[model samples]
Target: MIQNTVPGATRTQAQRTAATRAKLLDAAVDSLVEQGYSGISTQGIAKRAGVSRGAQLHHFPTKESLVVAAVEHLVDKRLMEILESQPDPEYGFEALFDAFTGPLFDAALELWVAARTDPALHAAMIQLERKVSDALRTGCLEIMGDRVSPDIIDLGIELARGFAVSALMRTPESDREFRERLLPVWKALVSK
Candidate 1:
């Protein structure tokens, strides 16, 4: 019974459901980023999304489920960006770098720390991490194509992740300087 706003076009039940789910997932990620995992509540997320609490509950019965789904949604989005990007090693590297350093990573980081203490979240994250890892690996391979070695791709991804983790402690300017210095070396290694 969801209504479509598109001019003269109606959305199917599935499309409406998907739209509602997407809104909840997006709001969930925003809450995670703005208010650490411990601070977020389902009611807050529903309010953020402008959806009813009942709707949010229907989509995600538990907080863990919502958080995990939000991470998965974010991962899927980043993977799509990686896949659609221009086929160049440098461009691909930058894309992966952005993905690792972006809001998606921020939300996931919150979940990762929270999961350490919450058994249910830990189990959910373990599975989501596997899926996310596989997807990103596949994205790296796609970006590098057959020109670069798998080892090189792995190194690049790991380096990007390292940079992401490093950002948590380092100043933004400092992190940028480090990345600027290291990117060329990484490019040279992969280009070989």
Candidate 2:
């Protein structure tokens, strides 16, 4: 009789670890959004996540570590939302660009402002921003190649990010205008 030493148990262990991580991140977000950076405690997060305090601490031994992971998770979720929300391919890159930029840019800029005052959060935010920029540059270079050049794409991206930063500084009405205005710039730069 063979003992049940199947790989399934290992896979289950990995799944449980992932689920626990997600729960911790979720709890951290809720706490941070509600209480800001200073107000969150590990016990509070554990209660929010419905996990044990020891478990929460085990996953994130330091407050700084927890905050950094929370920020990164938030940024990653933002990217996934944009990537998943793409309309049918027939609608094409124009729609895809609009969907990804408008809301994401505004929120990201606001988060950047908040992060500026906190070193751990600043590092986390910077890492996410660089990831997005690198991904964009890679995609643009692959499609446009030598014809357009990386410098041109880089410049345009900076310009768009500038516009988004300005939008976050404005009132809601003006923020809407900021998003609407970017379409022309995007079309000119990327459209064939």
Candidate 3:
């Protein structure tokens, strides 16, 4: 006689492991975005992921490791999005600005502040920053395609990041106006 089976019973052990890891990673990132690094707790992450605390511990034994993994997960996703978009030069600045100015940036800012005081987090952040910088450079190169010098592209990205940071201090409408006003000037400068 045939036996009743679960719908996902055919999934291999590796697939199940991967699925659990993905859920944890996603939940961790959401926690980072919502609670910042200082506020996140392993139990909270596990509850958000709908996984047991043991499962969370089994996957990420330390809070630092989980936070690092979550940031890396987000960076990888953003890099993939930038690579896939293949934006034209006219829209490239907007795309780069978008990448630097969202929930990812908010979480990153929180980590950056906390990393300043935590040695282990500082080290992890250094490596992660290098990875992000390289990926962003690659994406910029692909998007600009010789239209702008590498130095110019670097400067533009920094400027965009600066604007993003400044956004926290200003009203949203003022920030929008500031970007709109300066973006044209930046484009003109780069075009020369």
Candidate 4:
């Protein structure tokens, strides 16, 4: 038999498999953000990831599984980022608001909107949303434990989410002014 020759090839089969799975999951999130839920499909995800369909199928047998896994992966990544950031003593609330309103929320909002009509997607999202929410709450507590009450943290989260949703309609300049006006209010509320 001819000897097999593969350059490097240090990664085991399992490592390769995990790397492919991660690629697929990341592509799924990109699809959700770019195309929304209705536009997402296994084939599209595989194509986006530059992986073979067989590899995608082997990793996630169904579209639901793929999307759910992507959502979980995205949430975990965002939570870790939030948890790792240094909390600014004076601007902690601003930092937290920015964290909650970034790309992670955009991806999640897309899923939530799509889930409203799709029962299977809704079920998957509901379970994952709770976990994401809890992780965010815990992160907030950790970041603001000394300065803010838990109840205020909860309220601030709701306020930030609402502001994020509403800010979509405002111009960047107006949004900046809006946040500037509201930051003091939020600081006062949390300080109590």
Task: Please report the candidate that would top lDDT against the real structure.
Answer: 1
Ordered by lDDT, highest first, the candidates read: 1, 3, 4, 2
lDDT of 4 by residue, 121-175 (tens): 8888888978876876788877766667677777777888889889889998999
Model 3 bad stretches (over 4 Å): 1-6
Tell me the deviation in Å of residue 27 in model 4: 1.0
lDDT (CA) per prediction: 0.86, 0.64, 0.83, 0.81
lDDT of 2: 0.64
Better of 3 and 4 by lDDT: 3
Model 1 lDDT tens row, 1-192: 656778879888888789899999999999999999999999999999999999999999999999999999989887886687555755777776887876899998999899999999999999999887788778877876777777777777778888898888989989899888988788877677
Stretches > 4 Å off in candidate 2: 1-11, 84-111, 114-126, 136-149, 189-192
How accurate locally is residue 106 in candidate 2, as Cα lDDT from 0 to 100?
Answer: 39
RMSD to native for every prediction?
Answer: 2.8, 5.5, 3.7, 4.2
- Candidate 4's TM-score: 0.88
What is the C-alpha local distance difference test score of candidate 1?
Answer: 0.86
Give all TM-scores, in the order shown.
0.88, 0.63, 0.90, 0.88
Minimum summed lDDT over a 10-residue window in model 3 is located at 1-10
